[model samples]
Target: MGMEYEKIHACSNDCLLYQNECEDLDECSVCHESWWKKVRLYGPMYLMWMYLFERYVKILKAYFKNRNRPEGCVMESYIAKEAVEFCSEYLSNAEAIGLQNKVDSDGATVIDFRKIGYKNDPFILATQVKQVFYTTDPNDLELSLVVLMKSRDIRDGEGDADDCNCIPSVSRGLTPVDEVDVFDDDDSNLVRLDVEWTYGTRSGGVNRDGIDYYNNLINELLSNGLEPFVTLFHWDLPQALQDTYGGFLSPKIVDDFKDYAELCYREFGDRVKHWIPINEPHIFTTRGYEYGSFAPGRCSPWLSPDCNGGDSATEPYLVGHNQLLVHAAAVQVYKTKYQNTQKGQIGIALNVPWVVPLSQSIADQEASNRALVFTYDWFMEPLKSGSYPAEMTTYVGERLPKFSEEQSSMLKGSFDFIGLNYYSASYAANGTCKRINPRASTDSCVVHLSERNGTTIGPKAASDWLYIYPKGIEDLLLYTRDKFNNPVVYITENGVDELNNGQLSLNDNIRVNYYADHLSFVQRAIRKGANVRGYFAWSLLDNFEWADGYTVRFGIVYVDYKDGLRRYLKDSAKWFKQFLL
Candidate 1:
């Protein structure tokens, strides 16, 4: 048929493609094979293989009317087919020979080409398709058909199905694919639940709906043999509180946060033996108050004109100070009123990138230590020693908030454990003091760099800020042991992300390797007596990641956002299952 094509030679064992430099090679480099074999190339099959074109050729061959003039007959038939397809658009009851009518009586069309006789029937309606399944087990007999009919009913109901909770029913069908139990498969006994969503105004009363939902969720988790670790605040301050007193910027937030924490303790503390009063307070303080990139956005006008009017130099310090006070207050209430009766352990989740020196110079080494003092030790020192780091006190000066003697004692040893989120590391070098309009970020007098001398600390992840430095986990744990009096620690949030490029494959081996490497380091840290107690992956499901939104996926379980929000376990999740086993 005069079709253009190119013939490429490849190894019989599929070691490598014979192209470019290897075009003239007679045998495979690795296997030394002489004959052609199945080609293993990257990307979509349509672009790299002949199978699709071969199928099209078969279709074209069927258009031939005469053997003597096969090509001419195909050309004539193809033109007539195209003309009929164009004219069919104007005819109400007519359709092209190969095209089925999309519209049916109920405005829905279902096509079934599996039946032998109906394969070529262009106008097969919804009634013609039988709900069929082949299963040896009696329970699996009607599973797929029932789900299909239920989905159709949901679609037909439109807005009516919005209120229908189908998870319990639909999840039954998923058991055959992956019979995962929280305690059995993942070996996850401790589960973290964010309680910030339940915070409401004192005048308007507690959020009953949120409380009820959590009560059910908590009960269900416990029934599944899982313990709940409740977090009171995860940078989700109530809008009412933020509007009333500028949120964490004002000291007024301390009592309000304390009240909210107490409420949670009263309601759920009995069942929730593990409590985390705040998750990543430093991130909340800097991102929300100084950078103005997060909720209740506020920063120095000079830093960002779009800020909601804030003092970067003072507000970040104030916010951080108040958050510390808030955390202390919550811990005090829990330890005083709830701890004795509930028998619970409380902590705060703090995240910090492990800081390394840019070079071996003393200045860079000291800067790296100073950066840690400013970041990790900023909160840790206060909790352990009842005061901020000396580096922070000297550099930030009057801008840094001081705790009164009474508050200082309350701040000391506030937690039974520390929940640490370590993802990436950065190289720090000594930086010049910003004499003019210095903000909290620059107050450390340390320049943070991902790379030095054109070499990165580690491989980059989908999130530009996240670099894979698995050793950082071990180093950070050891540092925590040495600097913070070896407090019991839980590695709370640690995972990497990949771009959501709509790839269909669930072979997430990179994520598997990431988890394996990081977990191995965690084990090493534990072996070295770092007092690390537990480890939890950052996420279980692909979710709405703040700032980045849905552009990146950090979950081991892949969520098909395009396909009814269905979930499939990636290779990493399977690896985790086996690892835990």
Candidate 2:
């Protein structure tokens, strides 16, 4: 395996077969010395016809299988046979394998990819992969297993494959629990810990135990050598406070969040550094306010309900004003009090969806632009430049509150990075700015992102409201980079949905493809100078999918709602772990 130097790119199973194209692309030195030493591996004419059939037949089968499964789950089914064996050989360990079986006559073997490695393991995850990939017959069953093994990582929920070097994801929205420990140097090893500044424990009450729970979770994660991420606020917004003051719409939240964040940082800052102050504020606010879907359930527009200036109700802009104040105040508090002690990155997360027009007409473009402004620019303006977007005034008029110069400066330049969450896209066409009729209030049709023909676009998925759109992710990222002068970005959330055990394998392969395509595009954006850093696949476990309310499963680890037993580790999770390693 020395002296024949040619560029090779084979890793898990992408073998870069080299050839001297100027003379003999056919005469591979390695192939000539194989089992059929006297015969050439291929004749010149056979190479073209062979790729069409021999090389891609399994790939085609996997495609049809993938189409019918969770989404990409179908496509991932067919992998290059060499790739399969490559994986089998790399992770060849058997400390915890629970199931191994031959799957039907075609000879596909389903091995538990997660259980391939123990504390001590080989590099060939499948029992055959060596230091570098070398040629084997395309029909090799072991290679096929490698393909399936990697695909399983991302196909559904977390599995035994959870032990990869990829960016790690931890539990979201934690609740406090009683802890027991053994008195030893490894005391931290006995606990499973995580931090949540504002999580609802039982009856949606603030678990006043964010600090203790997170401390243990962080210590345990550190003991396990896992890099922990602490999201300061997810929509859990201390139910007690929401009942006390009106939540984000009330400026009082600024003080409340400061105290809460202070406690979390004080407890877990050493082990937990990356902080997300709020997860998808746009989704939380719009879903709750305009749609009356989430917590606080306030449907009235942000300004006074009286456009005539009579009946006093909070208007949209006024509420936005409070959101800005709270966000800025919290950031200011973090910077003033904790920045010196804990030198970790902190930022806000945004839920970005693609907005496209049906046509090239100026009106149509304007419609699409307007939808984006209402949905994203509402928060983007304050985050990027510390002021509301100029367009808000046209949409909300007096309802869009004007922040004083002092407030604008306070909100400006406050983030270290941006966490982007994406799912789908919408078609926009001209529409009334704000609807006042009750009929309009009853329907969940988001006027902000709509099509004129009344036919909403984008491929349909588990959520009736979201149309699966891969390009939306690309557009949103490029757009964000252009708007914010290249802030660091991570795809904090991006997932597809599916039902388990109905007709399909609860395996979410489509979600896997969705991630690959979107991430591939994200990689391209990075090549083009977008400071995108990492990606966190939405949920680590299939738990309650808010609003949709547990109907849709997005975790890499499938949760058995009964007795809370989690059994399935998704294909996507497995694949992602490989990419990380």
Maximum-lDDT candidate = 1
Pick out the ten consecutive residues of candidate 2 with the lowest summed lDDT: 70-79
What total of clashing residue pairs does each candidate reach?
0, 62
Error of 2 at 483 (Å): 1.3
Badly placed stretches (over 4 Å) of model 1 are 1-188, 197-204
TM-score of each: 0.68, 0.61
**111-228 per-residue lDDT for model 2 (tens digits):** 2223322133211111000011112333221121111112112333242312311101211111211111111111111111223333212112223332333454455545543444
Q: lDDT of candidate 2 vs native? A: 0.48
Q: What's the TM for model 1?
A: 0.68
Q: What C-alpha lDDT values do all the predictions have?
A: 0.62, 0.48
Q: What is residue 125's positional error in candidate 1, in angstroms?
A: 51
